[model samples]
Target: MRPNPDAQSPGPCEAAPARKGGERPSRRLLLGLLGSTGMLAALPAAGQAPTSAPKASFGYADVVERARQLGERPFDADAARIPESLSQLSYDSYREIRLRRDKAFWRDGGSDFRLLPFHLGFLHDKPVQLHSVANGVALPIPFTTALFEYGKVPVPKGLSPSLGFAGFAVTTTLNHPTVQDEVISFLGASYFRLIGRGQRYGLSARSLALDIGGAYPEEFPFMRALWLEEPAPDATELVIYALLDSPSVAGAYRYVVRPGPTTHVDVTATIVPRKVIERIGIAPLTSMFQAGEGDLAQRSDFRPEIHDSDGLMMQAGSGEWIWRPLRNPRSLRIASFVDENPRGFGLMQRDRDFGNYQDLEAHYHARPGYWVEPQGEWGKGRIELIEIPTDNEAFDNIGACWTPEAPLPVGEASEFRYSLSALSTTGPLHPYAQTQHSFAGSDLEDGHAQGQGSKRFIVDFAGGDLAYHLGDPARVELAVSVTAGSVMTRILQPNPAAGGFRAIVDASLPDGQTGEMRIFLRARGRTLSETWTSSWTAPAAAAPPQPSE
Candidate 1:
């Protein structure tokens, strides 16, 4: 998900009103007041007497109450104000300001998990409050400049203790027992990235999506506060609570993170909309797709392929598996699959061979795919895919999410629960033969001119029950259909190298028009492969060159 420089920041935790003469309460006094309420731990002065108190209980219910109260008031867009020095830092300068690992939370607590706060700057100007929850007590983790090592960025002198933080990252002994590796990060709005063992970061999951790829400008809701529960010394999972806020809605989120070969995050969210939301996306995923096998003509770099994800995989309520190969279209493309209850969906990077990318620095082959499995009945909704044209991979141009058929009720709470998995390989997820690769080009070999809008597509399906039917190739039939075009020729043959079957189709589309083509394999009366779908946009004829006067 892209960052919004103007996104609203979360309001600060409740505190005493400003004193007389428009003077705010001192940090020590505020801490003292909070200490009395058992909401914060105050540090004793150099010579002052030690002050101790019982800690108050805190959990998901507390955050839900905060969100509900936040929704009742108008959103305060000016809650966070970044210093001019920090707000003006360039990307390179911002990178220089790194959190010191030595000062990380729970660094010496005998726990496997560590939390590192991100300094506020660059695209992440809004600061979010952080708290540490131990036993039943919640203590705010106050921000301090000593927690960061500012290399060259000219941080102004005497920054306030309440400056807060842009976000935070969670690290653990994911790869090696002694080596700490980052497993998850909450940064830039409601976006959070995850990676499993032997995998690199790619797509991101969002708490909610509003008016994305719609007529109205998209809204970015951000995490205003986060409370991390201290894990046991031998705990394998970490629990986190977050307060999300935007102009249209406020939400409370709980994430149970478990890191392993395939990392899993169990998410539960309760959202209260300030008004009726016409377009809301749940279990939203964002990624990048500059160019891939299906659209090789758009490639400019030396790499044969460039993309975080190559396709969108979905399991419909009817139990049918469908794979739609992603494309870097010349224009904006939006496709929606209407269903009552989607089993699951994800943006997958099916092509994992390094040779295809040839970019050692990027290591695109190692990017992990994220699958969202709904925990409860999502009811009637449509899985929407939005592809925005991009010339380079620096920008994320692909988005997918489930949009409910009915608008969210105004001033009422709606809850959604799902499990997100960071997958390196998804062969076991599909029961039928999967689409190995897809390629398309002009159908010049069949006596069709290159510019005549006739195209040839070669799709390979491998694995599953295809091997059992390889002995009798004739029994396997190819099923192909086009929504706005005509199929000229279709053929299915055994691909011994793939241990499955290959289907080739020659289709013609009207000039300057777009069409969708779907193909699958079947034997007898049973389907033997997942449906492979793609879209094609016939190029418009070039205009005749005007003669020079």
Candidate 2:
């Protein structure tokens, strides 16, 4: 089955709030990667097959060098390579061609990890070359019909034996030491997703994003080839090397993935541009933001919320924590949070209550929040958040990436290294109070102090000292700011039920205009919470809410 774009199950554990329990590849051989001269020493021929003896040597240095050389030449769009039969297969028929579990690489060899390669069909007709490496030699994974269990679909008699893999899934005893479970997958373009000890695959990470949410058409880079390094018998971490190619750039990527309570992937990539890229994105992330507490009126579903992520959180280099609640906007919107050197940023799913989603099958609460922590100073870049209008939860319309202020120099290599954390919750990292939930609504009551067109923002903060020092919450003060419009009232009160504090901001909007608002809690001149930010846009016209199905 195609990876569910919006609904991947987390783990078996029930999610707790931030204040509570919620507070949470391979290598090819030498010649292919390193080129001819840089090959490692040849191994002694001992296997039965003399004709297939180890060829040239390969390593990460060779892959980077190859990428640099490839970028110097014009990109070759290798289309028409997929067989017509495979391309014409329907989605259902494609799903029928499943990889046989028993035939997985290393499964029967008593290794800690197993690899399953995907068949080329349906939307993934562009085959990606996959290689397995052991003892410094690389061997291309050969394609064979026997590798798959083709349910009822008939395989063409004359299909080429040279067909390559589309992508692959790696499995390990992630859930339990004795049980094999899918830990991560690399499929389709440059998209890949992973799960921690308890995380289900929710969002995906891209090796690089170019021209996303820009004026011109976007470019999608694909994993041209991949090398899977043979893991030791009892290895805990897996290594993968990939060559990425697109019209504008070519790249070499290395991922050191370790699955744990918080699965961490240490990513290192070097990008060599064929052309100057004005809008390049580093460590981009893709997720869904169909509707959340901030824009629940847009959704007519029975679930209180339907989203893979609810907010964008950034820890700026200035030590300020910024939280931007995601929205299902009426129009495509791009928000940029400029910074000189960002500490970190991520698309977070803060609300973990199952009641909020009520999706028994989807299990949105278990979806992990993906955080990007730069390994070094990335000097002068903006965290770009792109929100696209969507009518349903199926589309992954929310994107966050780091965009460098200056364009990438053509023919020169640029590198970025970062650690990706698949977090169950951000509470454990932040020492101060943080936003757990936020909601917005029109203040329509006539007797209310605020009149029509005035909006009320109710934000909840939990964890840290919020529950301790805020016992008399009246002592807490709400720090509020607005780019436009006027704030009518701002108040902070203790939420005994949540064991936290709630801050409310009431503001009157200008006719047919939009305004930016920011709010946070401070007690006795000390910052008590992350700054909660949102954009208020006046609807062109109001429509009656549709009844839930």
Candidate 3:
């Protein structure tokens, strides 16, 4: 299934060169340069002048009703048909087809923020219903070429009006007084992503996930209609309403977005499946983890580490915490943590070392770390982690969600609600310390493979005042367990560089089989660290070298 476009920053790849009237190439041309961009399709537009949307009384119940109605039928989205002139241009040309800043909704004299629509073309051919709320009723926001400057778009001789906007973004002063940062964006499917101040965008959150990562493949749900609610004249918050549609499920999403250094949004959703679903992933966060602490020595990148998030940080019902280091393994892997009324979980970006990613433009280090905090009891379920092995970072191969122990049956309905906050470092409780690093190498001495079926593992812990107690390194104890492997030498040592300690262990498995292992560190006889667990899988045996016979 196609990724929810809202979460990913599709490179300004559609960036076209300067054209006549300062217009750039069209989305069609630029997308062709990158790849064939997919669109949901659109209907014919009515010939008319653009108009403002009327106000409508809307609330939570309206949201549920929207989902319920869509669930009763099949989801069919029509891609927008643009005038041929715009379609023929390159990415830059299409971008040059700008929406006149002067035409911004409520820009003249209404509020500090104004509504600016997106141009059609490229992956945005799908026409989405955009509405504005004012007074008492909600009215449709009509479309017309009058709202935009063709630039070099070469508007066709006769084109229809009501060719609605592609999608929209909210721009506000994030840093400088006059600088408007594109904070929250709703484009592409039932997906939308946001970024906080001082953070670059990475990863996305979806309206709903239907049978994700399944053998039967997955179904992507797209948002059909959006209601942009202009906040109270003095309000700093922004509100949006979205209707999500797909073959399996239909849903509604209400987002109240507040942007800051730790941009946060309160998401409330109601999904009604047209049919029963085998799996419904809720409060899900999608990210990429190429390689990190646990297996850094195993990665091929020049940097010491590369990932959007480091590990799964769990604050359990019993008040204990757990941290599972992320792994980019040989195949798709899913890890689950079952609990009753979970506190919260998210795909995090813990390692923020700019040196980790040397590239200047794609500041992977500045990517935001998102956290999901359940507003109420979620019952028994698993915090599932699905890792799809990749040799690159272009794809988001890491997925973490709450897979309910209970599945919503076909033709049946269920409701789940939670709040997710996109955080840089504010979400998680400042734990006394964290496992800073982990290393794995041959168990043999002199760096040669001497011990058959043997490997040595090193783990480091840093943060807080753990180093001040250096005189009591011997007093530190470690609880390491090998659930299904054989162990030999284990040592707890100190690393002066990171101001932390390390847990070194050696293990052997019969026939090079795979198993699960768990380890933890304790200081001054108190359980000092979260449990560090890993699942090891045997690599597929390589083909025996073919000999000329």
Candidate 4:
């Protein structure tokens, strides 16, 4: 689902969190992607059957040229390149149609991976060309029923065969011979999500984001064509070169995916902008945040929480590790953390307990936390977190990425390179206990809302040295402060059942003004726990509103 907009902001993902061992398309594509029927019908009526030499295929180098040439003109996306039959299917019907395992191309080629084209529908209507590199020549992967079995939907015969691919999914048969595991997928816009072993899909990674969180209409770039490097028959690794295009920029991307206990993917890119761009988000993540225990707004659901990611985890370049809980807000809010060559950042689903969510079909605990690490020194810039107001959890409301310290000059080419991992944990898989949950309400003796300027913040700390540090945690004072507000009361107590400590920090603002609060465990001022920071704005009656930090 989505994050709760009203909860406090979480920090950037820290370390390299990978799977710690704990954690569809459809139809009318029944035809091909490239329009082959038109070419066949145009051929002369000579008695000779319509026969032709291999058609020219595009390659990785071609994508570079396209980006360079695009810089001379405006960017344009051609989603219509796909046929009508493929783009009209619904979600349920699309899932029913799938590529047959036995008919996968290069079945006898000694390859461990299979290439399945995405069935166009819903958000993935853009068509992209797919190619296979084998004997030095790149060949097109054409569409045909041999690859998939259309369930109940009737086939529309003579529907000009267009043999193009919407996108591609790479599968690995490491553990199972008859079944293939979907390891990576590149579909819809410049968005391609991957996973490490044991990690379930949770967040998404995008090639580039332009004008994001801006007052103007947002721009979404799409991968128009992909040149898949032909894998050796015994190849366990795969490389995919892609062509990214949109109204603002054109770029090239290369992804090398290696699957295992901690599956990793190395991503390299060279971008050529069509024009000036002030806000360019690299390694952006999209997730849903609906509500949390802190949220007093009651709904019909009985579950305690509902969200895809809990907060943003970031390790600043200065070695300041921070965790900001996510929130589903009532208005648009953007948190920008200016930094130079920041260590790493990610949107993490840190609260991994089955009891946190009761939905069996939607396994919230299995979702992965993807973290991005820079390969080289990226110059001065800030990691930005954009939280959009959403009523339902289905829509992705959280966007986090690196916003360059300097703007990309107009009509000039810019280049950036970064390596990222899609993992399950928060990084280093450390044994450090963390905040299991954050709850809030008016501080009263018996859980009743009290009209006190001292707002209560209930925080649950789990994992660290809870057994030894529980009762009367000496030196563990509640360090609480609020900008545009004041701290009225504070207290830290023991939760024997939770086997952890709880802090009830009660604070308030002088008036209805924007307030920022930070709280965590600190003993002898040595920073006993990860810092929790958040920004909140008072209601109109409180004061002039300012978005959270």
Cα error of candidate 4 at position 210, Å: 1.5
Candidate 2 local Cα displacement, residue 240, angstroms: 0.4
Model 3 Cα lDDT, one tens digit per residue, 272-353: 8787677778876677677775565557657666666777777766666667778887667767678888887776777777
- Tell me how far the alpha carbon of residue 152 in candidate 2 is from the true structure, in angstroms, after superposition: 1.8
- Candidate 1 local lDDT, 1-549, one digit each (tens): 233452211111112233446664332332122112121112111122113452578889999999999999998888867787777765456556665544556766798987766777755677888777878777776666665666776656777766777777788898999987779878768888788998877777888889888877788888899989988888899999999998999999999999999999999999999988888989888877888876668788788898888999999999999999888876778999999878999999988999999988667899899999998898998999998887756557788999999988878888999999999877989889999988887644464554557788999999999998999999999999999868898999899999999899999877677899999999988999999988887777678899999
Ranking by TM-score: 1, 2, 3, 4
TM-score of each: 0.88, 0.86, 0.82, 0.80
Highest TM-score among the candidates is held by which one? 1
Q: Which stretches of candidate 1 lie over 4 Å from their true place?
A: 1-3, 6-55, 443-453, 539-549
Candidate 1 overall Cα lDDT vs. reference? Answer: 0.79
For model 3, the run of ten residues with the poorest summed lDDT: 35-44
C-alpha positional error of residue 473 in candidate 1 after TM-score superposition, expressed in Å = 0.6
Worst 10 residues of 4 by lDDT: 35-44
Per-candidate total of colliding backbone pairs: 0, 17, 30, 45
Off by over 4 Å in 2: 1-57, 443-453, 539-549
